[model samples]
Target: MMMNKMREIYGVVNMILFPEDEDPEMLSLELFSSFAKAKERSEEIIKEFIDDYGEDYIEHVTKKNPVAVMGNGDVTGYVYIVKTHAL
Candidate 1:
């Protein structure tokens, strides 16, 4: 379910995981800083746009990762998701 705006995305629906999961901790995004930093980064990006193209051209865009990790310690497969942009 990819989306388009400024870029192409592999997600829009099921922003977490599909079919859910047995353990809530497995797919939870508590440890990820990207989601937490999104708002702050968007503010900075918006400011940049506002400065260049004016406020009207600026849009409040948000980004997120939907991957998840399951298991414990080394056995836990940690799928790293990275956001190329962050303020």
Candidate 2:
């Protein structure tokens, strides 16, 4: 008898925008099969920001696992973001 193996799913990439005076906003970018892919996408977003702003406005880009508390929460599987100012 052959046993079936389960496929692992990696986290997602997100882009977060922080305005100078307004509230911050988040957008779900994409889901990747591996962390490497997710990281790459995150970097790409950062580069895009630099290109647009002519400077590095990013605060941080991180990979995080979302946890559920009593099944009541805004659960985003794996969220990554490039925190920047003024957009």
- Quantify how close model 2 is to the true structure by its C-alpha RMSD in Å: 17.0
**TM-scores, all models, native as reference:** 0.29, 0.29
Model 2: runs farther than 4 Å from truth? Answer: 1-33, 59-87
Candidate 1's TM-score reads 0.29
Q: lDDT scores for all predictions?
A: 0.46, 0.43
Q: Which pairs in model 2 have colliding backbones?
A: none
**1-87 per-residue lDDT for model 1 (tens digits):** 232322222231333455453443333433344666887897888687678666543332222343556665444543434333455
Tens digit per residue, CA lDDT, model 2, 13-86: 11223233332221121232356697889799868877876553333234333334443565545544444467
* Candidate 2, backbone clash total: 0
Clashes of each: 0, 0
Per-candidate Cα RMSD to the true structure, in Å, reads 15.3, 17.0
> How far off is residue 82 in model 2, in Å?
7.4
